[model samples]
Target: MPSILGGDIDPSSWSIIQVDLSQLNIQFLILCGVAGIDLAVEVMPDWSELPYDLLVLVSRCFNLIEDFLNFGIACKSWHSVATKHNFNSELPRIPWLMLAEEEEGNSFRKIFSLSNGMILNKRIPKASRKRCMESMGWLFTVGEDDGETSLLHPFSGVQIELPHQYTTVDYYDH
Candidate 1:
């Protein structure tokens, strides 16, 4: 009699088993029961090894930007899927409210997601002491002292300079 795992067991009694990956835990229990093995054994799947197509499919299921970004941080392969252009465009866009800065000089800003009630703390030093408004998906920021204006993309930290506020207006004397 050969042992499966150093235990006195007959291999002939065991039959081939098919498992569904989605229901892995339940099917694993059934396999253990059929094989007369201990139920205490634990099995953990390597999520990073998931197929690229499957990972992409899972990435699309995220409606919130915060959740979508966290999915990319899971592993390198998942990061690849998240960085793809317009990978999440199919998902619904939820409005995110940018809260006031915690302190005058602090670089961190709190953003609240209306869709999921999640708050994200983002460090945007460029936005410090600037009046910000959302136009489309970018932040239109105006400098407090100089009255300069620029567009800032909060997530990507990309900034685009626009003509200064003075250039857009002409002073008229009556």
Candidate 2:
């Protein structure tokens, strides 16, 4: 006799039973109708309907570049909320080295983040080609041709114009 999963349910152990498909469907429908009646059914919240304050608070909790970036890209509402505020607060992110490869005097920059160990090679033709300073998780850069200073957030690709340089500061040496 053939056994199923070491069980004694062989051909002789059980009798063949037939089921009516339509009758079973009807019974299932009736059960559903009875259970779904007059219970003030609860529905899951939509993505946009999530609380704004809660999202901002949760966004501030993440410190890693990858983790924070992933949180912002999760949904449209999340992205909007994250960009509108300083989600990381005063918490310092992992320092990343932005080293420009000197190729024909116009080179691409390699950003290596210490937080998640992500190496990004980017070409910024629109902005500065050389790094000026790296302090407190921000990169200050000066354009080669225009000498315009700009601040960049390495992981997020966010750049902002810096005020005019008042004094000359040596970037290479102390």
Candidate 3:
């Protein structure tokens, strides 16, 4: 009979064996001795400490923004790579559908993705207590009672105040 590592061995002496990678210390040494393999044990790598360029390369493989955001939360180094705005995936980003506000004074809003049927709860305090409309990737908001108007970039948390609804001239009234 032929041994698994090569050369001939007695079939009567052979037996089934199972090795676990996680508990590969003493058992691994014993296996190497049996197989005539002279090798040293090596330590596993810490994934969080991977090289910066390698992490960036891995980050670029994620086409979904949700997956990319989750990857950033894995470790500080990964977060740095994710926040660098360097994603260059060939695939386009999936558009998210912003659901209506749940209740008054709620800081979170539910966003749905059509591609994967995913729902993400995003914290958007600026849209609270306002009537919001999506236009050109910006949230056009108007205050319910104060009649205040503004344009908000939901993801970046940027808010630009516009003139009050009553202050703007009615072009249709000409």
Candidate 4:
């Protein structure tokens, strides 16, 4: 009986049921009935096949910036659609503020978006034991001993090192 189903079903299970779908028509009918009654068994559509314009429209309709960001990050296809659209202008006017707290030799930074009331925790690598300054979406980290300055984007994870002798205060002043 399992050989008839092309080895997809176990012979032991066939013995338990005492019946096998002996015909293709009977199998088709059973499958159609099961599909109609079972929503969980429904096939998922390919998100990559969705139109770019439609995805952008849906992404821009999100109320929260975090949700919008997450929608874009859901897949590479979705991200490509998001990057091509000017959805950032549609986001709420949120001022992102960086708040830092130091505890037990570790520094924790929280970025709060005033418009959406979303607080995001930002991780700064290699700057945990250093003096850090946050302003205008940029983190300026200064090494305690070497006094080296590095410009970091906490959320985007992009870091650039300045000249070894560069002063953060002087750089910011200019």
**Top candidate when judged by lDDT against the true structure:** 3
Per-residue accuracy of model 2 over 1-174 as CA lDDT, tens digit each: 557568666563354322456668788889879888554578877866579888778888887747778878878988877763545767765667776555645546777777677888776543345546776766788766667788876556688888755445764364
Global lDDT of each model? 0.82, 0.68, 0.85, 0.70
Q: Pick by TM-score: which candidate is best?
A: 1
Question: Which pairs clash inside model 3?
Answer: none
Cα TM-score per model? 0.60, 0.49, 0.57, 0.49
Ranking by lDDT: 3, 1, 4, 2
The 10-residue segment with the lowest total lDDT in model 1: 13-22
Cα-based RMSD of candidate 2 = 11.5
Better of 2 and 3 by TM-score: 3
Q: How many Å off is the CA of 6 in candidate 4?
A: 48
Candidate 3 lDDT over residue span 37-99, tens digit each: 967678898999999999989999888877888999988998999964766657687788999
Candidate 4 residue 83 C-alpha distance from true site, Å: 4.2
Predicted candidate 4 versus true structure: per-residue lDDT over 1-174, tens digit per residue: 447656688658867565554566578778979888553566889977788888777877766556667887888878876653546564555568776555635656667888767777766555666677876667788787877888887767788887775544575465
In the order shown, what is each candidate's alpha-carbon RMSD? 11.0, 11.5, 11.8, 11.4
Compared with the true structure, model 4 gives a TM-score of 0.49
* Count of backbone clashes, every candidate in sequence: 0, 0, 0, 0
| Candidate 1 wrong stretches, greater than 4 Å | 1-51, 73-77, 169-174
Task: Compose the digit string of candidate 1's lDDT tens values, residues 3-22.
Answer: 65778755443432323444
Evaluated against the true structure, the overall lDDT of model 4 is 0.70
